[model samples]
Target: MNQYLLNGKLTAKPGHQEALAAILFQASKLVATAKGCRLYVIGKDKADSHSVYVTEIWDSKEDHDNSLKVEGVRELITQAMPLLDGPPAKGQELEIIGGTEI
Candidate 1:
């Protein structure tokens, strides 16, 4: 099976980190139900309270792209925009070499 990974950061506007994290956590639950989602983990940066990190593993690149189309996923993205400090952090797409099963 083809596997894809996304590791990125999201910076929240001042005093909005907790709110953003909550939204991300909610999105994680929604992503868990996605067909090809293997893992969706969200983390907060200790040094920067306004920064959040996300790590996702999908069965394929297509799966990852399609996830964005999910209604709940889309809603979360919309809800997060206003809390974001700027655009989401740029991330690299990696072909998963190996990983433990979810």
Candidate 2:
């Protein structure tokens, strides 16, 4: 099995902090339970409400691809549409073998 990760940075629309947080909260929940998902989280940038981070883990590239077809995943993306200041960027990743604790 291969694990896949996505790291996204988001910036909210002007004066839309609350809206962005609300959507992020709901979308986190939606993504956490999506098929093939191992983990999903939304995090603040520590500098501004407009800046945020989203990290996700999937069981495999195929699983990640399949999850885009899930209803919850679709809804989460749709919910996020109005809150973003720019298009999100994502990366596929592999973990470094020695970078974890037992």
List the candidates' TM-scores in order. Answer: 0.91, 0.74
**Model 1: lDDT to the true structure:** 0.88
Candidate 1 residue-wise lDDT, 1-102, digit = tens: 669999989999999999999999999998888889988999877688889999999989898889888878888899999999889877778887765765
Highest TM-score scorer: 1
Residue 84 CA error for candidate 2 (Å)?
1.3
Estimate the Cα RMSD of every predicted model relative to the unseen true structure: 1.3, 2.6
Q: For each candidate, what is the lDDT? A: 0.88, 0.71
What is the C-alpha local distance difference test score of candidate 2? 0.71
Considering summed lDDT, which 10 consecutive residues are worst modelled in model 1? 93-102
